[model samples]
Target: MAERILIVDDEPGILHALQRLLRHGLSAPDGSRYQVDECANGALALEQARRHVYALAISDYRMPEMNGVDFLTALRTLQPDCERIILSGYADLNALVRAVNEAGIARFIAKPWADFELLSAVRQVLQVRDLVIENRRLADLVRLQQGQISAQEAELRRLERLEPGITHVNWADDGSFILEDPGDVKL
Candidate 1:
């Protein structure tokens, strides 16, 4: 399935340009395409985020009501797994730090960015996101299997407590179970 991406910028031109670039230049590592969505401002972007899932969000640094840092910070609360990127013409050290530390932005691309650089950042971010998600899924599976094994072990222990040596098997040299006296079998 194609992953969804959100783009938030106050400038209509920048939004259009970013949409075109992403639509034409990027695809997931698995060769699936992206479904790009755009919003003119952070408020609209947040609204869209509440309604749909996004794999990535690219936001302009300076907007009217909310800067990219603020918008992305709020977005993190809504979608902690969604990767974030900041684009700005203005290079404010403090704002950049805030974006990184607070919003957890994956990349900050300067305005007038090279097409290759932007595309590469998006690709790398998506790849990392995929890896992180896969790792979480694997960890969950491992945890679930461990729990099942624990339950099975507990059941065996309970049975052993109920009947001593019940959990043990007498194996013959030929790899078959060596049954003792049939009268000795409990159940």
Candidate 2:
């Protein structure tokens, strides 16, 4: 499946350009294309986020109602795993710091961005996101397997308690079960 990306910019032109750039330039690590969704304001973006899962969110720092930090911060609460990038023309250090600290943005790109740089940022962020997701999946699998093993062990112990030595078997050199007494078996 194509990974979904959310783009939030109040300016229509910037939103269109970003959508075009991402659609044309970026692909998931597996080579599947991205599904890009755009919103002209933070409220609209948040509304969209509630409806669908997003792999990443790219937001312009300056907006009408909610700034990039606020939007991304709110997004973090809704979708904690969604990666974020903030774009801005103004280099307000405090805002950037808040973006990094509060929003946990993955990257910050200055406005009038180079196509390659933007593409690279998206690529790298997606790569890292994929890795983190895969790691969580693997961790869950391991946990599930461990639980299965524990259950199996408990069953074995219970069987052993019910019938002592029931869980143990003697093997013959010829890969057959070694009977305690040969004459005890019937044809």
Candidate 3:
């Protein structure tokens, strides 16, 4: 399975560069490949987001029409489970804070970011997402198993009530008892 990733920036150069940088190297939490899509502005990014459910979205701050924070907030409405990251070129304090507080971005990456740092952040966020998904799966399995155990226990209690004095009982497929020991039986 390929995990989808969206990268958006107003600068065509930055968008292209990041797309190139991110294309081949990263792995998703499930050990799957990454499928990346790039856009030049926030509106296009939003459109893409609506069309597809992305595993992660990385957007640049200070875009012409909409900033990264607003884009991510809207993206959240479209797909709340999609993880987010903001790329801030100038260390805009207010926008960074808003991105974290309002948009619920997982990380803020500065401009001129090292390749290792960017990939590392991406890995960590995706790993967290995968862990959350796995946890939910395990919880569901536990619930199902518990329900089955409860049913079996109830059946056991009913059987006990049916033959309270019998020490052992085994039935054949045709509904006939193959073995029955009343516990007080003598040889």
Candidate 4:
């Protein structure tokens, strides 16, 4: 499935603008582009997040219903894998810090943001998110392989108990099998 991004702003124009910037600018190394979804406010954005898993969410800091930080925090519980960013015109340092420490936002973009900067932030965050998800997938694969190995080993022990002192066979990856010992048979 194509990766998706969520953009939220109280102003309709801002929402539309951010969506356009991301849809055209954010490109992955494989030439993949983002599927952009826009919301007019934080509350509706939260609902969208619940319905779909987004790769990233970019939200304006101030909104009539819920603020950007709160929206991100709630999203963390539902889709903790999603990356987050906040856009703000205000210089409220404390709130900004709270957004970082509390909401675990990936980055912040200022209002009237530079097109290049916003695009760069989106690319970077999505790259990191892809890496994290890939790492987890690989880890799970390793765990499954290990479990199979352990089960095979256990079965081998059980077979040995049933036929004590029987000659064991080993198989090579190239599809050749041989008995470890061929006792005293001269033919």
Return the clash pairs for model 3, or none: none
Candidate 3 accuracy as TM-score? 0.73
- Residue-level error in angstroms, candidate 1, position 61: 0.7
- Off by more than 4 A, model 4: 148-187
lDDT tens readout by residue for model 2, 1-187: 6779999998999999999999989887788888999999888888777667789999999998789999999988777778999999999999999999999999999999999999999889988988886775566557567784465666665454333345678899999997564234221
RMSD of each: 18.5, 19.2, 19.3, 18.6
Instruction: Give the per-residue Cα lDDT of candidate 3 at 10.
Output: 83
What TM-score does prediction 2 earn? 0.77
Residue 23 deviation, candidate 4, in Å? 1.0
Q: What is the TM-score of each candidate against the true structure?
A: 0.78, 0.77, 0.73, 0.76
Q: List the pairs of residues colliding in candidate 2.
A: none
**Model 3: runs farther than 4 Å from truth?**
29-32, 144-187
Error of 1 at 139 (Å): 0.5
Q: Over the full model, what C-alpha lDDT does candidate 3 score relative to the true structure?
A: 0.79
Count of clashing residue pairs in every prediction: 0, 0, 0, 0
lDDT of 4 by residue, 46-137 (tens): 76765676888998889887899998898776677888999999879998999999899999888888998888888888889888867765
Model 3 residue 76 CA deviation (Å) reads: 1.1
Full ranking by lDDT? 1, 2, 3, 4
Better of 3 and 4 by lDDT: 3
